[model samples]
Target chain A: MTTTQLSPTPRTTVTRGRSRAVLDRDALLAVLAEGLVAHLGLATPGGHPLVLPSAYAVDPSGPDAGGTLYVHGSVAAGWVRGAADATVCVTVTLLDGLVAGRSAFHHSMNYRSAVVIGTARVVDEAAEKERALGLIVDHMIPGRSATLRAHTRKELAATAVIAVPLEEASLKIRGGGPVDEPDDVEAGVWGGHVPLRLVAGDPVPDADAVTSGGPVPPDVVARARAL
Target chain B: MTTTQLSPTPRTTVTRGRSRAVLDRDALLAVLAEGLVAHLGLATPGGHPLVLPSAYAVDPSGPDAGGTLYVHGSVAAGWVRGAADATVCVTVTLLDGLVAGRSAFHHSMNYRSAVVIGTARVVDEAAEKERALGLIVDHMIPGRSATLRAHTRKELAATAVIAVPLEEASLKIRGGGPVDEPDDVEAGVWGGHVPLRLVAGDPVPDADAVTSGGPVPPDVVARARAL
Candidate 1:
């Protein structure tokens, strides 16, 4: 039920805007779990950075639940290969709403974000890699891995899974309505929080499945309904 | 109107998984403009990369339209100071849906993202900095800057604005239903896309304004209605 707290290292510390930084481990993990994708920053051989989008998941409960972040992609991905030993940065952000203020300068957003800094190690063991891949799949669609066919040897070989420890991670959150200046607040100008959320629309079954004539699984239907 | 296309240089080229790469300049700009925040990747003094979230704006149409990305924050921000002449990677991603496949390995996401590789230049001129600040404010809520009180000279001095050119940017997109393997498709399992979108809810007026009883601005009401 608990993970280690965020470290006080210079890289992980929230120096600029201290009020937004969250040090609690569980809160940080919750932010990570809420996001579906992470922006991974890797340093190229030439010393330039590449920030790319990739699906990622965090262990919900286990020894690695709060400490390890699992990310997988095609074996041919250049960033994945570079991340094996190179220092990397991963960020997951969920935008909740737009904070509207009386003054444009005070406008902001209600969001939750987590940033992890570490060197990613490749999961070479087949068993561990397979489980990591499953965590990722289920991360997107809960209970999905159990319903799908197991990953074959060929499929497993074509995938690359990397693990980054959350030793130097930090969570930042901004919530609630706008904090406009006192003068602006009394100026009779409108100010409020415009809530924004990710809503899922009805699913459109694939064309190829029409001929197959198979019933949609209960879990898939349930997931869509919850969204 | 079109700006220059993505460069064919080795670093900027789409070397791996070429199918997801998009070379159209306008397409890349559109993706950048869709997202409210951008994850900026910058290297630390010790050469480690850190990816952090910050508000951003793209000039929609003008001399700098589709070519310049503007990002601003407090002058006290370390990353903003480090990014003055350092190579920076700016990424803006918009998640559209969850692409569910019959097999775990084939599951994917529907997203549009743009990655820009360039060194951020500090905007030091007072006039240009002020103008850039307005551009950013209006980017989130159109026509907002004109109605608000002018930013104080002290506030302007305490802010730093960075500009990165989009000349070496590329857009990567994946949409529609999952492209499961032929065998999986014939396995008679359900597969489809769970469409996702950022929906805006009704605005809740600030508590302080409740007593003032000021009318909500038309632009604020219109923006919420459109969302």
Candidate 2:
């Protein structure tokens, strides 16, 4: 597979501290794929901006592959409506650990984050929209989408799905242990990294399940263990 | 303790999808207190917006208490410098699970999110800046500030600390199992919640620790267990 090069623009450039910026498209895609939620930033019509949590997935094998990030919500969501026409920023971050440095000034977190900037186009076609919705479901738990009840036509109409091309994006990350100053290291403080990971606990079967006595599906069990 | 009410402004009102907006000030504060990172949204001088993650803490006691959220970074960071007078949106989100509903459309995640909107004021005073830095350190690991090496004057001057007031804030949360439609419930599909939790593993002692063989500090040990 040939890879496309993404030239850094003024907006995608990391102008701040350190050399943590990751410019490779594949590297950025990896960060987006692992993250479960994205914080979407949109400006109100009055021009005040707001950042809200949202669920999203990257299309791996489709016309939109390597180009589009899919996000969906209720049809009436103000951001969902406003995003179709306005340029927005979607950020996905995964925190890996708490870096307990030797001093108060140097404490940091081990994390991987990506920010994508673009205007979203609404997926209005029924077939395409349905596939995007399925991608989202399986994105959270692979293979479970096939087993879940299909989306009704009314349910598809009630949902708003938008695709934002991944043309302008950048990734930043920090890892490993505390980078303490020489003096602080000599001061004999208990300093190291406390690793943190997102793990899955045992699934709690819904009490109101109309269908009872069936064993928990193997796909769901595998997803839990994978997490 | 008297709870101050936050009046709903045009920006604070949840004009979007479901009514997941949280109104209680103390409730919003609790979300802020439990969060480890915040994604700050800012517009570039060229009019494009961006969201970047940063470590933050709410000041529990001080002249800035009850109104300020503290964030700090290198003095040379572009976003940190540009954010002083700009109206910014700081969002903190905690993910709790993968809600696998019986159908694709109803899939969701259990999460608690808080969005704070306001202009950030640079903390220019040396003493206030120092205190804010300590607050951020302790915020990640409770009681960490008292044991860490003191911030040297040079480190204080090298950092830029900004305080964004928590006046215009709102909380949104979703919990429990998938809310599947009645028809899907009757279809006998697997439906439940796979809980996702952030857990900490044993601390990896720094290889360069000047003092060796010391037991891990109780505060650090407790933090790992609490996660």
Candidate 3:
């Protein structure tokens, strides 16, 4: 059942930085949506932990317990083979700023992160797989998927989409300036944060596109500005 | 022994995307140095995999097998306790651009990523731990450590520094514009890429810094510009 509050399982609860833990479901979704890539962690057959970055998408109305998070990979990837039906951890982090404290001990980063733990299942249903693929594309460039042609059958066959329920999850956010000790602050040490953001530069069209293709589409321009 | 080329172990070999694999150790180091946070993966005591983001620093002339990668955490953190002497994976990714292919299948991201797998050990040595903490601070803001006072005894006691050898590692890079299918190109579909970069905004000074502290240091400005 969908819940407005994040009901973190015992394993997902934040025990160390309890003050940074956010229990609002919308906060978790915001973190997932703003992030472009996710780090998927799982164990190989030999039991060694592995972490790999992959493009991901989230659907709040998805058919999982609370929602669904989709991460795609090449079907031939070794990690993809091990990810099917395996207990995995998905972590997405967006670095907001760099905290410059008066002392080294107080130096930290301003970031928003979401961690989801669940058993990942490979999507085999053709319809859901196709929709997930579209969502993934739109997640990167909104409205660009509709302008493109349909994926060929062979292309679909080579891709593997893994779905994980966003049921057991936690969100952590650390923002604002550095919290320096009173003595350090009184010492008049320069302290603050420099904001960091992912920004898009001018689009570089393919050589062939520049020669033959028409002007860059409005959707592409909008996507660049949105970033 | 220090080697210039990356000698990937069987587990670190790039079987799926061999063409994108980089064997140069310098490339791996470049990616690590550019990244601010790393996703650390390890199996918890219950055997469930966990992934968390942490600030990290790389020391090439370190005492580890090849080099050393350090990640610090609160000593009270549950994962920090579980990470000591355990097999772990650390992945650092810097997203470069978004590939807008003619079709959804060819859409991808241009990025430089480094993945290191090794056993992690807690830094118990007083000197090494203190040096690692300084490195972590300087890694985030170069030259800022020298400007600050030393860490207090109690502050150091609350921190746990984990070191992982940079021996088993692999680097993958994807750059340039979209590689669309010939058919899609023939259809006159506009395809290109938008470059993405982490940029720094103006420094937001702390309330006390604005009143009593001096101006933002040159090192802080250099760090912001470097990004």
Top TM-score model: 3
Candidates sorted by DockQ, best first? 3, 1, 2
Fnat per candidate, as a fraction, reads: 0.75, 0.72, 0.88
Candidate 2 per-residue lDDT over residues A1-227, each given as its tens digit:
01112566777777663367655888888888789999988876766678988888888564553578888988877777777867888899889889888888778899888888887788998887888888888888888778866688788888999888787777778888888788777767767888999999988778765356166778778889998
lDDT tens readout by residue for model 2, B41-110: 8877766678889999887564544578988888887888778888998999989898888888778889
Question: Where is the poorest 10-residue window by lDDT in model 2 chain B?
Answer: B1-10
Error of 3 at A134 (Å): 0.2
* Per-residue lDDT of candidate 1, residues B1-227 (tens digit): 11223875666766565777666777877777668889999988878889988888876552353467888988898888789888998988888888889899989889887888887889888877878888887777677778788887887888898988766777778888887888888778889878887777887788886768376666667666766
Q: Model 2, clash count?
A: 0
Pull out the clashing pairs in model 2: none
What TM-score would candidate 2 get against the native?
Answer: 0.93
Per-prediction DockQ: 0.72, 0.66, 0.84
| TM value for model 1 | 0.94
Candidate 2 vs candidate 3, TM-score winner: 3
Runs of candidate 1 with Cα error greater than 4 angstroms are A1-5, A60-66, B1-5, B60-66
